[model samples]
Target: MKNTLLIIFVLFIAAQIIQTPRDNPLSDPQKEIQAPKEVHAVLKKACYDCHSNQVQYPWYANVAPVSWMISRHVDTARQWVNFSVWEDYTQEEKEKKLKEIFRAAYAAMPLSSYMAMHEKANITMEERKLIRDWTGVRK
Candidate 1:
């Protein structure tokens, strides 16, 4: 009886995973990154999962039961700051938003839940400094 129940549960989970969307909303070529490769990778790892249209979701994000939550999170994240649409923002506004987001990140505010799940997203002191320095230079 227990074995049968386990198989049913596994099948249910597999069914959910099959339905998660795999669309790429960032088809705009203008959304290209000019930043250093390391910086870009760091941003992708820490920010793109939620904030951009080109999310490289992990295996857990692909799993069915969590796909809904992940999709909602991605939608909200893009609303706050869409890197693909970033070129549309004024330089001043871009600098301001970067400063604001980085401040919140340093304080561990904007993505506490995300950091809890993806340990790599937890900004290191060096990474924080790099971000701050990059933003400051851009300004």
Candidate 2:
């Protein structure tokens, strides 16, 4: 049993050495999404971490398996829509992303796991309406 525990500890330590890459490239503010201050506040609170080029990784994100999951989620979210580079997208792309954002605002976003750790990021119904209304996309 002692040997097994020792092995597990060693494996856990070894896992930390294999750091997952979590990159948030330098973003141009001019390229970021333009929205009313209220809308931007909601986005900054609930969406930017995963959806934009402004991920605020938590301390656990530097640990092993959790880091891998966080990195992958951020990468996938950026692929869907990196609001930090909003102006870089074509108009059509922006429209599509806005539509997606409109849908996501209802309940599918600010992922549950994320909200579990970030209480401040939990979007209220009013905030959801704000995001959807800001997107200018209908259901």
Q: Give the top-scoring candidate (lDDT).
A: 2
Which residue runs does candidate 2 get wrong by more than 4 Å?
none
Give one digit per residue, the lDDT tens place, for model 2 in 72-135.
9999999999989999999999899889898888849889888899999988989888887888
Taking all chains together, the TM-score of candidate 2 against the true structure is 0.94
Predictions in order: lDDT: 0.73, 0.91
* Candidate 1 regions with alpha-carbon error over 4 angstroms: 1-22, 62-64, 109-112, 137-139
lDDT of 1 by residue, 1-139 (tens): 9999999998877778466565557457585544677767777778877877778777777666677678778887778777777787788878877887677557754377777878876677787778777767432
